[model samples]
Target: MTNPLKTQVLIKIDTITYKGHSVIRINIPPQKEISFVGEKAFIREDSSTVEAKGPKLLAVSQLFQK
Candidate 1:
C-alpha cells in the first residue's frame, strides 16, 4: 500500500508566518508593482489585503515573483 502525500503550506506577512493546509504568499515589490500566489489572487491598492480567497489546496514551491 502507498502512503498519502503530506502537503505543507505557509504564508508570511512581514515578520509573522501563518501555517495551515492552504496559504497565500504575497510579495510586494518596490514602487506600485504587486505579486501574489495561490488561486483568486486579488491585487488591491493596499498591499495588506492579499489573502487566500477560496478553499484549501495543495501547493508546492508556489510563488509569485515581481
Candidate 2:
C-alpha cells in the first residue's frame, strides 16, 4: 500500500534567447522507518554539508509531522 504522506516537488526554469522554459518533477516518498544503511543525512553549514546525527536527526524528522 502507498503511504498517505507521499510528496512530490515541481521545479521550473525559464531559458533565455526565446528557448522557452524547462520543467522538472521530483518524487519524495515518506520514511516508513529509520534505517541508516548506506544513507547519511547532511545539512548545509556555511559552504559545506555536515553529517546529521543525534539531535539533528530528531529535528529533521520533526519537520514531516502533520
Best by TM-score: 2
| Model 2 CA lDDT for position 17 | 44
Q: Which portions of model 2 show Cα errors greater than 4 Å?
A: 1-37
Can you write out model 2's per-residue Cα lDDT over 8-36, one digit (the tens) per residue?
A: 22222233443565544345444644434
lDDT (0-100) at residue 30 of candidate 1?
36
CA lDDT, candidate 2, residue 9:
21
Residue pairs that clash (backbone atoms under 3 angstroms), model 1: none
Cα-based lDDT at residue 30, candidate 2: 48
TM-scores of the candidates in the order shown = 0.19, 0.40
Residue 60 error, candidate 1, Å: 37
Error of 2 at 44 (Å): 1.3
Q: In order, what lDDT does every prediction score?
A: 0.32, 0.54
